[model samples]
Target: MGWVSRLSTVIRTQVNDWVGAVEDPEVRLDQAIADLQMELLQLRQSVAQAIATQKRTERQRGQHQTWAVEWYNRAHLALVKGEEALAREALSQRQSYLTLMAKMDDYLGQQRQVVEQLKGTMRTLEQQIAEARTRRDLFKARARSAEASQRLHTLMAEVGDRVTGGVFDSMEDRVLDLEAQAAALTELSQMQPTVSLTSQDSRETTASVEAELTVMKTRLGQG
Candidate 1:
């Protein structure tokens, strides 16, 4: 059971590591930012719609109020002309317009409030997007740093490589051997005479001729 649990844990860990490697932090951040931007767009649209509705309601309310006043004016004219029945009809029409105007005012208030809430929601989304942009840069830096660290780890992971082939030791020895060989070559070149080896026959012939000239001079002197 313990072994089974350990195997399961290992598999899970391996899967998680694979997932981590495949996941692109930048892509995720960009997607998240895009989603927020879309939400912000939707909220802005909602706010615009709410504002339009409120404005339309307000306009309707104003028109109703104007009609109510007109009806009251008609009632006044009826009273001046002594048409009592006509005056009652005018007042009744005025009351209906006033009732409708009141209802429109209520609707306008609710619509305005909805617009305010949508505006607030849009502001919040904008703020989140701003913060997300900052974090995206930060996370990108972190991802770069993490990749560098992983490469370093991969390069240094072979604990046995140094021992198996004396890799480091061999490298050092090879470098030293090269340096010694170079130094030996330098010394040999410095010790060599600056004479032309290509003219060995000429050098030997000149030396022999000089020796014969000296012998002739000695013989003449003796004679």
Candidate 2:
């Protein structure tokens, strides 16, 4: 009895400890989910920023191309008017615009590359977020299961104590009664009528009556 009581106490203590650990794991899982969500938000912002930068670079490239064309046209008109020095200066201005256009094109290309890279990164981050969410749910479910298992263990330990205290004596009596009833059923099945020579031989005897008298004597002794 002492060993049984000690074992039950140990089980209860272990269950309490495990329940606390399970609760901690659930909390950590939630924190991890929140952290992943924050990371996803940051990735989205980065993707948005990359897109904005790409758009700005594209607009700058277009504006520079237009300016370069306008400069070239002006330079050609001045040359056709025979203003040599003015045409020369206008051509120089046109060359400057062309240089600016080339630089803008290079920058636009870089911006486009950055945007594509950012988009890829965003996709990867989204995938990670999805995986994290799945893991969070799995972890949470495991935590809940662990907690329930711990609770059940604690309950079993308590119930085991109650059984020792005789609090469940009636339940024990009921269970014994059920067992006796099952035994009676088995006895009745053995006594079932059968088309056999041995059964016919016992049918006219007092075998069943003797079996009932024996069971009654045993029951009286036990009481």
Candidate 3:
């Protein structure tokens, strides 16, 4: 029995410790949602930058293509003017622009992919944020309800303790004392009549005895 009691005490202590160590769900959930929101915000910024870079790359690619076309036209004009060396130089410049344009095209393709990936990630993060918000709201409501219930239970327990503790015991003692006093008063009242009757009987007996003594004296002529 003693070991059982010790085990029970240990269990209770451990349970209390666990309860104390547990974080408040409402606070934890709020923090978690805040962190998620921060992550989403940062991701959105990254996505926006990625999109801007993609647009810039596209613009650069377009400019290179335009330059390539201009160089080709110049090359054609130089050939018509019978300037072979100049035409060759213009063709070389056009080839350089075309190479740059090809490189830009490759880079743009990769950039588009990166932008799409970022957009997709943003969408997923947004969904996660939405889910977190919903869960936070739900958990907060549950926490509030649990706290309210706990408060009510505590109040009821306090009331129960008051009713069953020293206050209640003292009231019981007071009632017992009142009853005892009433009983004593009743006993005293009952004894008063008996005392009065005994006194009257003693006086009557004394008077009767004195009268008999006088009669006896008168009968013996000694009065």
Candidate with maximal lDDT: 3
**Which pairs of residues clash in candidate 3, taking residues 3 or more apart in a chain or in different chains?**
none
Say which prediction, candidate 1 or candidate 2, comes out ahead on TM-score: 2
TM-score of each model, in listed order = 0.62, 0.67, 0.62
Among all candidates shown, the one with the greatest TM-score:
2
Q: Which stretches of candidate 3 lie over 4 Å from their true place?
A: 1-23, 161-223
**lDDT values for all models:** 0.79, 0.79, 0.81
Q: Which residue pairs overlap in candidate 2's backbone?
A: none
User: For all candidates, what are the clash counts?
Assistant: 0, 0, 0
Candidate 1, lDDT over the whole model: 0.79
Better of 1 and 2 by lDDT: 1
The 10 consecutive residues of candidate 2 with the worst lDDT sum are: 191-200
Ranking by lDDT: 3, 1, 2
Judged by lDDT relative to the true structure, which candidate is superior, 2 or 3? 3
Give per-residue CA lDDT, model 1, range 1-223, as digits (tens): 3444455456556655754764666777899999999888888888888888888888888889999999999999999999999999999999999999888878877887888888888888898999999989887787777666654444444333334445677888999999999999999897665446647868899999999999998999952
